[model samples]
Target: MNAVLRTLVVLVSLVVAAPVLAAPAADVDLVKQRVAKVGVLRGEFSQEKQVAGFKNPLRSQGRFVLAQDHGVVWTTLKPFPSEVVVTRDRILSRQRDGSSRVELDGRQQPAMRSVNAIMFALMSGDAQALAAQFTVKVEAKANNGWSMQLSPRSAMLGKVFTGLKLQGDRYVREVEITEANQDVTRIHFSGMSETPAALSAEEGGKFE
Candidate 1:
């Protein structure tokens, strides 16, 4: 079978299996509550991107900081150095020299605004927000861990991303994004630290 056809089969199988998917909703609620109490989070991440026809998956490593009140700072340290800051109002990409390479105001771009909301929901573990945009299924695993599958509800988004799978104990540790045409992006997060204190000036400045 061709790659596109194979991907369609995989997606169809996932949808057909959805009826049997079941887990404790209360457990997910408790996990969301625990995540809500965390105001600041810092972690390191490694990401792998696979595209159809590519001989090898592209790999990148990075660190990130998420402040509920401020925004998110994502620094890519591998392959090349780059940074992206996403806030409620705008998204900015900064070069290694601390100059802005690109900036998109959410007020002007509806698509970008939606992207910002989804990123924040993913980073914050906002179950309510996530549920509003995707159909979710949760399953508990051994060792106090859990997994969730989220399928996009919007037709437009469905064309871009068919589904996402997230796994974690208390905080999100891994995310797998399955897109149309059989491409996939997987991110693994580790060394997470959650704090109640505010972000430092430098971290906060990224959003500005």
Candidate 2:
């Protein structure tokens, strides 16, 4: 994938932990109560992107780590080995040979700073933060399962993302992102865990 597409994938992967809720205040509280709060969450993910005019969707599978205090580590192991790490200050990507590149520097790009804040809020299940950006519609299901649809509220965000749909019970299981150009990306998360409650030494090194 090109750098811009790769960056979009990284952003989608980081928000997999977001809580799905309705626009109503009570529903927001209800959804928050249902989602599991943890300092660290790790999982495996499979993503498929359906680009306009492409007959087949592009697919990739990988693993991800979300640390509330640190940031996210997304490792793409198929098709090619690569990794993307997002922290408060910047977004970094690594090649299989250990070469690292700064994808975005929040200090220099004010827009990236906002993106970083949104990412952190999503992963941390900050419903209020989400509500400020997207108009959310939620459906409650049996067994505490629920689903939500989100549309960007700002003109800037709307220029890129058309909408998003997310679903889960205790954790977000699926996410579908629709772009303005009609390209759609679907992501499924599995093997999620909160155990270990901390990053491994090697994983921690990626942030530095």
Clash pairs detected, candidate 2: none
Strongest candidate by TM-score: 2
Candidate 1 lowest-lDDT run of ten: 1-10
lDDT of 1 by residue, 1-208 (tens): 2222233333333433232223324345744645535678999999898988998998989899988787788888887788877777777776667654766666675445555656887766665666756777777767667777888765655766888988887788898988877889898989898763678778877777
Report the C-alpha lDDT of model 2 over 1-208, residue by residue, as the tens digit.
4333365545544344344334445357656777788988999989899999999998888998998788888788887778877887777777767765547676765455556666665554555567766887778879998777778875656767899887888888888889889999888889999989888998788777
Model 1 stretches with alpha carbons more than 4 Å out: 1-30, 34-36
TM-score of each: 0.81, 0.85
- Residue 181 displacement in candidate 1 (angstroms): 2.0
